[model samples]
Target: MVAIIKTGHSIRAMLNYNENKIKQGKAECIGQGNFPVDADRLTYIMKLNRLEKQCKLNENVKRNTVHISLNFDPSEASLPKEKLLEIAGSYMEKIGFGDQPYLIYKHNDAGHPHIHITTINVQENGKRIVMHNIGKDKSEPARKEIEQAFNLVKAEHQKKKEFKPEPVSVRVQYGKTETKNAIENGLNFVVNNYKFTSLPELNAVLKLYNIEADKGNENSRVAKHSGLLYHALNGKGTRVGVPIKASRFHDKPTLKKLEKKFVANEIKRQTDKSRIKNAIDNVLLRNNIIILPQLVKQLKKEGIDTVLRQNAKGLVYGATFVDHKTKSVFNGSGIGKEYSAKELRDKCGANLEKLKGEFQKAYSRDDLLNMIKEDRGLLSIDDITKIVDLLSKTESTFDYLNKDFLKQRRRKRHRRGN
Candidate 1:
């Protein structure tokens, strides 16, 4: 069972969308409880007719729509419509949907049961209301409540639970030496072979009679049959994990479990990235490399410009450069093959050169050079070699082999061996 609240769309648009879902008939309507007894049902009937007068009756109440859907394997015993309506009413009362105008219409046109609901966001007096947040709030609790009320064991425990229907065991008799009377009894034995929890178990039973079980197709109706999922448990037993197509399975717990797994993995990924960032920051600080503030100041001093913009890659730091000859808006990257701040500034000619000179005069070159040297010295000869090799490969130039590097490697190797 899942409850979804959607806002920011007109009532008519919402009605049409729900009407399409209802026409599929995958789920049954459970009736509304918020308004006068027949008022809720009246809206559902009226919405189906697309009657303008029916919708206008409650238009001034500032409506917001909520749809509640329940999905179960259809092969199992279905809850009676009267019982389903009772369940819906109890659920609404428990969740506090308020005694306002709301309708519950079951949709069975699809592959499963999804209930559509329309309600006023405010009470008859027109005060704003807070609704379910779905993943962030409601689904998990609702699932637990339903499982308890229905006396169905959690899906994980399906293997240990008994079947809901009477126990059926099967026995196989090989060879036909037994009389025709024995053959009828053997057939009875095979039909009672419904206890198995998995498809393989069910297949084993079918093999005895020389009748091969039809393996359902990818998109075929038989393939998506809900009964296969519920087959794990017979008499309201635990539900073994069964593959259900998106169209058939909509249990709240299943949805929450999926969301929980997704959120947990995402959180771990974000934490790992944070740790990586922290490690990089520590290395940069220890090596005295130019920090972000220093890099920004350097660009500003060099007369490099920047702007904020949104692109296909999302919100990003961007910049523009006017072509010197055409004076047209040219992106910073187009000013040169590489769009580094220094390269962009260089394209502005003498004024940029003068600015660079002024910037250089304002900072101590000795200090910046010392920082770079310190950072370089902090790395081992092997690390430095790897870095140089990477840069050489990228540039297609072996100019990275300076005399200082050869001396360091030779001295380091000698020191290691000694």
Candidate 2:
């Protein structure tokens, strides 16, 4: 089992997120304890309120909410609720939250069977449970003990570590089955198939499929650094390893060669828009697909990758479709305003009402646990336990999972979105 804990300020938002999913019938309120009404929303709110009310005695505790998810392997599916609760209780006791009131919510919306716990950090005595070094000092030890006691699959044994992009695996199966040949396959398919007026715009399409085109920084010391290269990317789109120079590819897709294609593609894509639009229309016409992930899967069958750009809050406001087979890039609005994020989301919302339970299978626990086995470089408990000393001082709630990645980018003079 893997545990991720976060400290936040709102009880309502966290509870509402899970409750909304439950109301949608995507999840269920499987079990609850230590509250007046165990099955209703009040069970969660009243307990959390009690914590906050007590914390008022302390006066300085601004952050009161604690959210944690316990994810188990697929093999552990059908794990009884009684056992799950026992594990949760043991975990709380080990982590110093045994006496604090909390609610456990089982979330099935993802590809794994997991439970969420929401509680406050403050005790009724108006004392704050020091969260310092909890992840390493307390939670880590508790997780291993729980796993051994339950005989659950250890994290290290989960899956291979390859970065397989979810909902878009169809692209690789169709062409470029080999990792080394992806450049030739993606470019041969894209260059002859799609249209783009610039390299950066083309890369937006390339980034979706893990084939990146690059020219070394202006002052790199390596000889022949001026040449363009192609690289593979991890799940996060960060480049990995040595790159294959543009000259090595059969088509010699160098910067100069691609610039020439850019002008021609502009004219070519103009004629191809109607054909491409029809393809997208055909998919949306189907009743089986809806929501973002399902829509991405259906489109991938035809070699299209739908990349949505969202703000920090996870609301997708813009989208891009990189057509690998035809090598075409179209903004949702560019394809047709009907394909824009707003329109698609609206359409998806309607279709979701009609989609059955099967469409959600892609997120099944088996599918999620399968990735862990494929997740190479996954750290084992033995490996983790070896690092006893710290490179920094005591790790607090902030060290638990507080990270802010700056998504910096230079504004493009040419608009990629319509």
Candidate 3:
């Protein structure tokens, strides 16, 4: 999970802050925090409006408004409300809220879970919170701390199966078409992964590279493409915008270089998914460990004792024990016989989970049913129906429910009654 922190006026404004910057690292206000580490960062974003509202920064300024904004993503262990309060309290303890105070506002207006802390530069104690390195000084350490805390929450949420997973597809909008397409395709192609964020910074880098960025409709001279844009970091650590024009720019050394660098990351992600799949399989196989407790008797009667363990393969696993001494092992006959429970979970169950989620989110049942029925070289209708039925019985069915079927069922019931 990505944790981003920045400051803005009226907690609402911070909540409403652009989501694009949080994901893509586009509209960034660097701060005093360590880079790429799990930590909380703080920034004193001089609000253009607040500054104009309060004529303190300049005579042309009109009124008293928010002078600084600090934002960060706290771990799920620390709820947004709690994190916001902690940030506000920490600042209050250090210097006390200024005449024009800062509030830690919980923002959900954007995609990623984030918060905003807006305050005046002047503290009540006559101490001033200075904006150093364009607020990089304050943002760095704060971001580190925030990441650390947020990571803990993420871990806990993962265990509880309640983690707010990110969207598979996220949209990124840019003020300029050149910048937008550059970002969309560049990041996707260069990174071989799709995520939203980084338009402004990408544009900034393109400007340096003399990439001729303009917002218009023109297919000539490399107009639109698919993939991702990566900031090509030179040996000197300066970012150069590198656009990966799919199919067209595949031969570029820069693209090849990034592919090599991120291949390891892709492998790691695949490995992690594989591991989680095995773990979930183990949980399911431990049928004796029933959530209702009553199922334990049924499992025992069937001469099945489910025992779960973390396999040497770095995945959770389990096996059926007929007696205290009799342990079930793979006979290498049918499915799941050759591979351990973890292997099966990762290979089939995990993917099923993702598919089921998408299946549930499917807009129309006919479309989904048709996809399933058609197989479409993916899954059989029978299998899809089974998953859908299973989802209906689950508690958090919102993400899995067949909304079209439910809607139709309601209509049919109403018609029958009429």
TM-score of each: 0.33, 0.41, 0.26
lDDT of each: 0.39, 0.63, 0.36
lDDT of 2 by residue, 1-418 (tens): 8887877666666676567657756566665545556655565456556556765766677777788878787667788988888888888888988887777777664445778887778787788888778899998999999889888887667641111222222233322324545555455445544587766667777776677777776665322444577777766776766777776654457777778878887777776566557767887677454455556667778777777765544456676777655557777788788888778766665543332233233233343233234421222232222122211212331233323321122223234432
Per residue, candidate 1 scores C-alpha lDDT tens digits across 22-102 of 554533345656444463356455653433333344565343444444434333236566666665665555555546455
Stretches off by above 4 angstroms in model 3 are 1-54, 57-83, 91-100, 109-112, 120-129, 134-137, 142-213, 217-418
10 residues in a row with least lDDT, candidate 2? 384-393
Q: What order do you get sorting by TM-score, best first?
A: 2, 1, 3
Best by TM-score: 2
The candidate, 2 or 3, that scores higher on TM-score is: 2
- The numbered model that scores best in lDDT is 2
* Ten contiguous residues with the weakest lDDT in model 3: 325-334
Error of 3 at 41 (Å): 30
Higher-lDDT candidate among 1 and 2?
Answer: 2
